[model samples]
Target: MAKVRRYSSPYLSDIAGGKVVVSCQRCGLERRYDSAAMIERAGDVSLPELRIMIARAEGCPRADNVYRDRCELGYDPECWNGTRPKPTDVP
Candidate 1:
């Protein structure tokens, strides 16, 4: 049998029942992405991959950091600091 590798982050398709938003905590950059459209476009990319993609797309200086100071880009609320609710989650 071939060895299988598992990733700790969720694939884009694994996110469910909520709006998908990517944001940068340090610079206050943010974007709301349609999850279904994203899944169709990227074909189930892992959230970590998507985070880097977003950071690069937005020209974040820390996009390529591979050490302790990683880019702050992440899926909203859940992956990021959860103090604020995702915009869609607000009534």
Candidate 2:
């Protein structure tokens, strides 16, 4: 099985093989990522980029219409992976 890590900036390969744990701030929806489907849809893109583009597009978290979908990667906070990404890291 592929390794799942929780720290910072993940490469395209990370999401491509392993799983990404994501949760919503408003509703607290947690789930793993479907790498195969993602690759099929968006080709090869980094996890951070993937989050920004297509991370959570599954609509409302609870479907109660209480709060809008504010889905975000539970582990990642902003762009910095504990330490800021170098210029080369920012594609």
Candidate 3:
């Protein structure tokens, strides 16, 4: 398995919905994947692979989208530290 990332649906908590933005590596293309909208298939495919599958289905075989963002947790820019803040941290 690849490095587990907090932003991917496979590793994120189900209770707190999150969103993932996929930016293509070949041609500049961005797609948002929300926790609520993702359909999990019965297989061993990882989230990154799934992302590549999505990219391929969309007519791009490069399937190398590196731009991913974790939007539901400590990523808020309004945090006092000018960075993502934890739940207990001041925002």
Top model number, lDDT? 1
Can you list the residue pairs that collide in candidate 1? none
Q: Which stretches of candidate 2 lie over 4 Å from their true place?
A: 1-8, 60-72, 75-91
Q: Between candidates 1 and 3, which one is better according to TM-score?
A: 1
Q: How do the residues 37-73 of candidate 2 rate in per-residue lDDT, one tens digit apiece?
A: 6677776666666665543365644333335644544
Give the alpha carbon lDDT tens digit for every residue of 2-64 in model 1. 533367667776664445688777999878776778777776787888888878888988999
Model 2 TM: 0.44
* CA lDDT, every model vs. true structure: 0.73, 0.52, 0.45
The C-alpha TM-scores of every prediction are 0.68, 0.44, 0.43
Model 2 pairs whose backbones collide: none
Segments of candidate 1 deviating more than 4 angstroms: 1-6, 77-91
For residue 71, what is the lDDT in candidate 3?
Answer: 21
Instruction: Sort all candidates by lDDT, best to worst.
Output: 1, 2, 3
| Model 2: lowest-lDDT 10 consecutive positions | 75-84
**lDDT at 33 for candidate 2?**
53
TM-score of 1: 0.68
